[model samples]
Target: MQKSLKDLKVYSSSDFPSYLPKLNALYDDLFSGGKGFRSKLIQMVSRHLSLKNEAVYLLAQTIEFIHNASLLHDDLVDRSSLRRNKTTAWLKYTPEYAVLAGDYLLARVMVNLSEFGNIRLIQYTAEMISDLLEGEWIQDSLVGEWNVTLEQLNQVHNLKTASLFKWCLRAPFVAQETYDEDIHQLLDEMGGLLGLLFQRSDDLLDFNVRNYEGKAILGDLKSGYMNSFAAFLLQDCEEALRLKFKKAQSLDEVKLLVTPDLFERRLQEFDQVNQESIDLYLHLMEQLAQALPEKEQGLRDDLIKLPHPLYWRKR
Candidate 1:
């Protein structure tokens, strides 16, 4: 059965161990703060198959575990003070606690996956963990560098951000006893493309936009990091413009270069790259649609809901 936001919200309302207040708090931090985008993915896919009742809880929990684990480490690495509008784990609690909490969540994933008793599910979850960590490492290596190529950045994001998403689309099929090679590969490709689109669209938010940038704008540039979309945009900037962007040392310099005027100019060049990325993401989702011969009604609504949010994101 497909779970609703109301459903998952109610299901997850109870607190964890009272003795482990910090751990419980960590869980709450990630759980309540985020919109459960990935959980939505799993829910959508589940609609198309005869997914077990247990699959909903296990799969939802697994996605949260993977996401929260990454967030704990992400905050420490980014030294970010705010996440979803509050102090981060490493800030409110000690980094040691954060690390342990993150580790515990990952361990919990194994226990959660075991409930499904599917080796493939567990194995895919394991591979996602590896991919997520590797993606983080690659991005970390690029920190403080002002010029990362679009292809390299996208490759890293695909591995890190999309790998888990791929799992979201495919796991339900695997769990439904409806596993197929083509569907699995197609879902992975779809997840990667969606990940690319989501991340790149998010990158545009860093430039300039009205109302729905969602997060802080131009935060990436001020921080001296380049995203996949920005990399494409930067690739075409004049030598002098490139030097200005590369030489940026503070938020002021970033504002001067990454203004509305400059961004609009760059959008022209970003058109081809943007189209390519859109095609990539759409193609993946298309494959998923094709792979499932008879999707359930709830699955259909969920699948329809998938693109709506992604489409409205600032670009």
Candidate 2:
């Protein structure tokens, strides 16, 4: 049976002891009110595999802690003041404290995994975190380079986002000692595609299309990062427009480079591409469903729901 989000939260909350009141309070604030979407994803996959719920809870908490740790560090790196409509940890607490807090969570993850004592799982998770850091470094280096290709953007997201998704899907099997090469490969592909869809949808949110919350509009533009949508659409634009875009340092300057007609045309193209990607996501979901064992056919609907727009929506 699938665990409810509330149940997931209970597991997450009980994972740590309140030895330090300040740190505990900081974590409480940070973890409170989150949708626990990643944990939910793991639970869904666990349901499909009929894996042990207790083990799933631990893995879910591990992933969520790592994820929140990344966010705490990310908010500091980006100098973001707000996260999910609340003041970021770095700002509410101290930057130094925030850094340590993030590190503490990661250390806790290692300790938890060490207790679990699955060498393969630990090795894979360590590799995933390494890949995620590399993605962050690559994306940071690419900032202010407006000519970023769709391929380059995709590669970064594959490491940063898809890696976690892939782990969520395959780690349960790893826990079960199932090591099925075919299923692992299939999950990898599914995660890559789903990551692209999620990242692109997020990129779209930065470009004036209302979607997920958190980030401000044109945040990427101001930060000198050419988003996936912009990178793709810019490919079809003339060299002159591209040059003008390259010279832009702010969202206002970017707006000046694009006429209303051009903007509308690009948005239309983006919408078309987004719909195609959605179709592909659905197709992949269907493929996964067919490939799953007959006993797990009931999971098809739940699996499909994982990537549904409703799940992705913030408001």
Best by TM-score: 2
Instruction: State the weakest 10-residue window (summed lDDT) of model 1.
Output: 4-13
| Residue 269 of model 1, lDDT score | 61
lDDT of 1: 0.72
Q: Encode model 1's per-residue lDDT on 1-315: one tens digit a residue.
A: 554434665124352557887777776776675887787677667755776656765787788778888998988988888888988888888899889888887887897678668898888789889989999999988876656788899888888887887788877877776678887787677677677766776776675533273667667766667876568767756667766886676545655777756656776666556567566666655666665676443454455445435634543
lDDT of 1 at 235: 73
* CA lDDT scores, all candidates in order: 0.72, 0.77
lDDT of 2: 0.77
lDDT of 2 by residue, 22-121 (tens): 6887898899877777777888877767666667877898788888888898889888888888999999999998999899988888888888888888
Misplaced by over 4 Å in model 1 are: 1-6, 10-15, 210-214, 236-240, 246-262, 280-288, 295-305
Candidate 2: regions farther than 4 A off: 1-6, 10-14, 212-215, 236-256, 310-315
CA RMSD of all predictions: 3.2, 3.2
TM-score of each: 0.86, 0.87
